[model samples]
Target: MRDTTADGAADTTADETADRAGLRGDCENCFGLCCVALPFARSADFAIDKPAGKACPNLGEDHRCGIHARLRQKGFTGCTVYDCFGAGQKVSQLTFGGRDRRTASREDARRMTDVFPVVRQLHELLWYLTEALTLPAARPIHGDLGRALETTEALTRLDPDDLAALDVPAHRQNVNVLLLKTSELARAGIGGRKKERRGADLMGARLKGADLRGANLRGAYLIAADLTGADLRGADLIGADLRDTDLTDADLTDALFLTQPQLNAARGSTGTRLPESVTRPVHWTPRL
Candidate 1:
């Protein structure tokens, strides 16, 4: 629920306040955890290969990105797309008590680094759960979503050892079931039956200008696919691989479970319609 203002500042909107959301990254309150804890190989998205626990050269002592203004220009496009869902600050301030890995004891540092990714997964689930609760079509399962949200929230507060020991994949599978149900209910409200493409391997498929209203695209491999001008209103895109997907002029006004990361990895034009939850990536222009 954290959106960028016209000036690119993380501003809280009225909807965010109404939901009491904590899903936006608050870098000011974090210890630059992602810059150091996450690993990256030299790829189209990253400039260099960095192992886990190694700090990026552009990370400043103040825990701010030194190349924030030119990340894409400097071949660090992945950094711009990454969102910790407020996990960085929660792990920094609450779990580690503001102690950064740089200055902490070796054991604490290792644990902090390990616990970050675990907490991040929980926070991501919280983001989805919070969104699910907002859908009126999912009203029948609102109680379950609220309980899942509470459980995920509590998991994020666990000690580093407990968090690191968690079977996250198992938890994710359980949450996915509920999310799939939510998707069904939401799309059902869109009227006619939807295309059943859930878990389909549609990599590089040509789907330009297709009528995909109420489609089930969960876990679809849409990498490098042409989705230009597609009518994706009310489609379920959770876990969809959207890397390099062309979304130019596509209508995703009411797309379900679409995240900022997915949009960041895709190409879009000024004509692309998006939901209120996410901001269009800066590089998405007509020329792309």
Candidate 2:
């Protein structure tokens, strides 16, 4: 059974499990928008180069990945890590009223492609905003976060034309102000001199066993960095590029704003401790 609050209502403290249910990808309800709307290059992550608005050759007529079970083995690791945060279903159903791109007019299909990425960005903000409300330390700004969440949700319901014309980055900047404050309040409780490494280029750095507790690593480029055995509790990892970062035995018990896609993009071992919000990536090495 799912855990509940004292009154049997869904728990919103720390985990925000109920609030995040709709913020995750539900491909079954989607029309394969990610495979058709987004472009990807032929690299280690993808087996072939696909252009935007062009359906991936591997996408089936039923809107399912033909090679779903063997995506990694077939050199499509990027698809495994990508999550639309539930934007695909929202666009397929609510935004376009269950219209299938295969049957829709060419102009309508083009609009769907354009509107999808916009909603994806908004949904991602919803993910963070939902998380911010669950932090007890961020109670001071709960009212602001709540209002932002409501506004962002309303934006997602806009018509395709309106959604395409929406000033997303400007709104993101507004919402980010609150997230920064949330980070400050949440990290302040951790006992230590917090490190401020916002947007720092730390690519390929040797940081194994480092103490990153309460560190601000927002937008920091940690690509290919060795973070094995690091203590990252309470660290703000909002936009840290963790691609290829080694996380063997790392304790990220309370790491702030660490999303599943970021964890999936990195390398981890069975010993890596994670926060409650995300699960252990299936590709991580097992203990032998």
C-alpha-based local distance difference test score of model 2: 0.91
Off by over 4 Å in 2: 1-15
lDDT (Cα atoms) of all candidates against the true structure: 0.86, 0.91
**1-288 in candidate 2: lDDT tens per residue?**
123444433234544677788889999999999999999999999989999999999999999999999999999999999999999999999999999898888989999999999999999999998888788798777777877888899999999999999999999999999999999999999997889999999999999999999999999999999999999999999999999999999999989999999999999999999988899999999755
Q: What is the Cα-based lDDT of residue 13 in candidate 2?
A: 52
Q: Report the lDDT tens digits of candidate 1 across residue range 86-186.
A: 89999999999988887789999989879999998888898788788777788777767776777788889898899989999999999988998999899
Q: Which of the numbered candidates is closest to the native, going by highest lDDT?
A: 2
Which residue segments of model 1 deviate by more than 4 Å?
Answer: 1-20, 286-288
> Best by TM-score, which number?
2
Task: Give the TM-score (vs. native) of candidate 2.
Answer: 0.94
